[model samples]
Target: MKILLLGQHGQVSRELQLLLSQGHELIVLGREQLDLAETDNLRDAVRRLQPQLIINAAAHTAVDAAESEPEAAFAINATAPGVLAEEAAALDVPLIHYSTDYVFDGSKPTAYHEDDLPNPLGIYGRSKLAGEQAISAVGGKHLILRTSWVYSLHGRNFLLTMQRLLQEREQLSVVADQIGAPTWAGSIAAATVQLIERWQSAQTATWGVYHFTARGETAWFGFAEAIAAQLQAQGKTVAQLTPIATTQYPTPARRPLNSRLDCSRLERDWGVRLPDWHDGLLECLNASR
Candidate 1:
C-alpha cells in the first residue's frame, strides 16, 4: 500500500515512517512540502500523491497555547482535518487521523470509552473535537484515534521536559490531579501499521473513532517520579519531587482531571494491545541516551 504522511518530522510521524517503510511504500511531507492551513494546497497535495492511505499526524498540540490562539488552533486542528477528510473522500482513500483524549471533560471516574460523549474544557480539546466532527461530516472512510499523554524521544514532549527538569533543578513540583496513559509515539505508530495491514487484508468497512494509548494510567506527578526513578536507575542523581494539585500549578488552559481511555474497542477491532506505559517509557529513555 502507498501511504502519504503529514507532519513527517513529528514524533509520531517519525515512528510511523519507520514502521510503514518496511512493508509499504511511504511518502512523508513536512510543513515545507505542504502547509495544512492552506486548505487548497493540502487538498491538492493529497490528490497529487494519490495514496491508498492518508495518515494525518499533524495537529496544533500546545494545550496551553491554544487558549490564547483559539483561531490558529481551530485552523490547523479543526479545519485542516476536515479538508483532508474531504479530499480523501473525493479520492476514495482510507483516512487515518490522530486526536486527543482532551476531547473528554474528565467527569467520569473510569477510563473513557469510544462511545463516551465529548465535552472539551479548553480550546485545544474543542478544536480537536471539531476535527473529529469534520472527519465524520465528510462522509468518508476514516479512523480517528484519540490518545493521551503522548511523549517521545525525538520531539518536545513530557519525557524531554522531565529530562531537562531533572538536569536543571534539584527539586520540582508536578500536578497530580490529572491521570492518563503515558503513550509512546513508537507504540502508536506500530499499532497504526498493524491496523493498516489488517484493513488491507480484510477489506472490511471499518471506520469511526477509537482510543489508542499505552496500557495503565498515572498522574503527571507520578509519571514524573517514574521518570526520575528511571533516570536514577541509569546512575543519574534526581531531585526532591513534589506533587501538587492542578490549582497550585495553573496553566493557560484547564486540563482534564482524568484522561484515561478505554482500549477495548481498538483491541476488539484490530487485535492490538499496547505495552504498559513503564515499558514504553524505558524504551524511549534508552533511545534518548
Candidate 2:
C-alpha cells in the first residue's frame, strides 16, 4: 500500500515510519514538504501523492501554548484534518487520524466511552474536538483514534522530561490530581498498523471513533514516581518525587482531571489492546538504553 503520512518529526509519526516500512510503501512528510496550516499546499500534495491510504499523525500539541495561539492550533488541528478528510473523501480512500482525551471535561466518574458527549475545557481540547467533528461531518471512511498522555523516548514527552528533571533537580513536585494512562508511541504505531491490516482484509471495516491507551491509570505524580524508579533501576541518581495538587502548578491551558478512556470497544472489535502503562514505560526505558 502507498501510505502518505503527515508529521515526520512527531513521536507517533516517527514510530509509524519504522513500523509501516516493513511491508508497505510509506511516504512520510514533514512541515517543509506538506504544511498542514497551508490548505492549498496540503490539498495539492495529497492529490499528487494519490496514496491508497492517508494517515495524519501531525497535530498542534503544545497544550498550554495553544491558549495563546488558538488560531495556529485550530488551523493545524481542525482545519488541516478537515482538508485531509475532504481529499480522502474525493479519492474514496480510508483516512486515519489521531485525536486526544482532552475532548472530555473530566466530570465523568468512570472511564469515558466512545458514545460519551465531549465538553472540552481549553483551546487545545476544543480544537481537537472540532477536528473530530469536521472529519465525521465530511462523511468518509475514517478512523478517529483518541488517545491520552502519550510519551516515548523520542521527541518531547513526559517520560523524557522526568528523566531530565530527575538528573537536574534533587526533588520535584508533580501534579497528583490529573489522572490518565501513559501511552507509548511505539505501541500506538504498531496497533495502527495492525488495524490497517485488519481493515484491508475484512470485507467491511469498522470505521468510527475508538479510544486507545495503556491499561490502568495513574496521576501525574504516580507517573513521575514510576519514571524515577525506572531511572534508579538503571543505576542513575533520581529525584525525590513529591505529589502536588493541580492548583499548586497551574498552566496556561486547563487540563482534564479524568482522562481515563474505556478502550473495550477497540479490543472487542479489533482484538488489540495496548500493554499496561508500567509495562510500556519499562519497555520504552529499556529501549532507550
Candidate 3:
C-alpha cells in the first residue's frame, strides 16, 4: 500500500513511520514538504501523491499556546483535515485522521462515547471538534480517532516533561484533579495498524468516529508519580511528587477535568483495543532503554 503519512517528527507520527514501514510504501511529509496551514498546497500534495491510504498524523497540539493562535489552530486542525477529507473522497480512498477527547466539557461522570454531545472548553478543543465536524460534513470514508493525553519519548508531551522535571527538581507539584489516560504514542500506532489491517483484509470496518485510547485512567499527578517510580527504579534521584489542584496551576487554555473516552465501540467494531495506561507507560519506558 502507498501510504502518505502527513507528520514526521510528532510522537505518534514517529511510531507510525516505524510500524507502517514494514510492508508498505510509506511517503512521509514534514511541514517543509507540505504544511497543513497551506490549504492549497496540502490539497495539491494529496492529489499528486494519490496514496492508497491517507493518514494525517499532523496537528496543532500546543494546548495552551493554541489559545493565542486560534487562526493557526483552526487552519491546521480544522481546515486542513477537511481539505484532506475532500481529496481522499475524490480519490475514493480511506482517510485516517486523529482527533482528541477535549471535545467534551468533562461534566459527564462516566466515559464519553462517540454519540456523546461535544462541548469543548477552550480554543484547542473547539478547533479539534470543528475538524471532526468538517470531516463528517465532507461525507467521506474517514476514521476520526479521538484519543487523549498522547505522550512518548519523542516530541513535546507530558511524559518527556515529567521525566526531565523529575530528575532535575527535588520537589514537584502536579495537577491531581485532571484525570485521563496517558496514552503512549506507540500504543496509538499499534492500534492504527490493526485498523488498517482490518480495512485492507475486507473486514467489517465502519468509519466515522471512535475513541482509541489506553485502558484505565489516572490523574496527572498519578501519571507523574508513575514516571518517577520508573526513574527511581533506574537508580535516578527522582523528584518528590506533590499533588496539586488544577486551580493552583492554571494554563492559558482550559482543560476538561475528565478526558476519558469509552473505546468499546472501537473494539466491538474493529476488534482492536489498547493496553492499560500503566502497562503502556512501562512498555514505552522499556523501549526507550
Candidate 4:
C-alpha cells in the first residue's frame, strides 16, 4: 500500500514509518515540506503524493501552551485537519487521524468509551474536537483514533521528561489527581497500521472514531515512580518523587481528571490489544539504553 504520512519526525510518525516501511511504500513530509499553517501547501503535497492512505499525525500538541495561543493551536490542530480531510475525500483516499483523550473533561470515574460526549476543558482539547467535527462533516472515509499519555523513545514526551528530571533533580513533584494510560507511540503506530490493513481487506467500515491506548491506568506521580523504579533496577539513582494534586501544580490549561480510554471496541474490531503500560515503558527504556 502507498501511504502518505505527515509529522514525519514525531514519535508516532517515526514509529509508523518504521513499522509500515517493512511492507509498504511510505512518503513522509516533515514540517518544512508540509507546514500545517499553510493549507495550500498541505493540499498540494497530498495531491502530489496521491497515496492510497493519508495518515495525519501532525498536531500542535502543547497542551498548556495552547491555552495562551489558542489561535495557533486551532490553525494546526483543527483547521489543518479539515483541509486534509477535504483533500482526501476529493482524492478518494482513506484518512487516518489521531485525536486525544483531552476531548473529555475527565469527570467520569471509569474508562471513557467512544460514545462519551466531549467536553474539552482547555483550548487544546477544543481544537482537536473541532478537527474531529470537521472531518466527520466532510463525509470522508476516515478513522479518528483517540489516545492519551503517549510516550516514546524518540520524542519530547512524558517518559523523556521524567528521565531528564531524574537525571538532574533529586526530587520532583508530579500531579496524582490526573489519571490515564501511559501509552507508547510505537504501540499506537502499530495499531494504526493494522487498522489500515484491515480496512484495505474490507473489514472495517472506513469511517468512525476508536480508542487506542495502553492497558491499565496510573497517575502522573505513579508513572514517574515506575520510571524511577526501572532506573533504580538498572543501577541508576532513583529520584524522590512527591505526589501532589493538580491544583498544587497549576498550569495555564486545565487537564481532565480521568483520561483513561476503554479499548474494548478496538480489540473487538481489530482483534488487537494494547500491552500494559509498565511493559511498554520497560521496552522503551531498554531500547533507549
Writing each residue's lDDT as its tens digit, candidate 4 over 181-238 gives 9999988887787787788788866377889899999999999999888878879886
Report the C-alpha lDDT of model 3 over 1-289, residue by residue, as the tens digit: 9999998999999999999998999999999888899899998898888999999999999999999999999999999999999999999999999999999999899899999999999999999999999999998789999999999998888999998999999899999999899999999999999999999998976889999999999999999989998888989998888899999997899889989999999999999999999999999998978
- Residue-level lDDT of model 1, residues 128-234, one tens digit each, is 99999999999778999999898998879888899889868988999999999999998898888878878888845568998999999899998999999988887
Best by TM-score: 3
Regions of model 1 farther than 4 Å from truth:
203-205
Q: Using alpha carbons, what is the TM-score of model 4?
A: 0.96
Error of 4 at 187 (Å): 0.7
Each prediction's TM-score versus the true structure:
0.96, 0.98, 0.98, 0.96
lDDT of 2 at 258: 96
Each prediction's RMSD over C-alphas, in Å, is: 1.3, 1.0, 0.8, 1.3
Model 2 quality (TM-score)? 0.98
Model 2 agreement with the true structure over 55-137: per-residue lDDT tens digits: 99999999999999999999999999999999999999999999999999998989999999999999999999999999999
Candidate 3 stretches with Cα past 4 Å from truth are none
Which candidate number has the best lDDT? 3
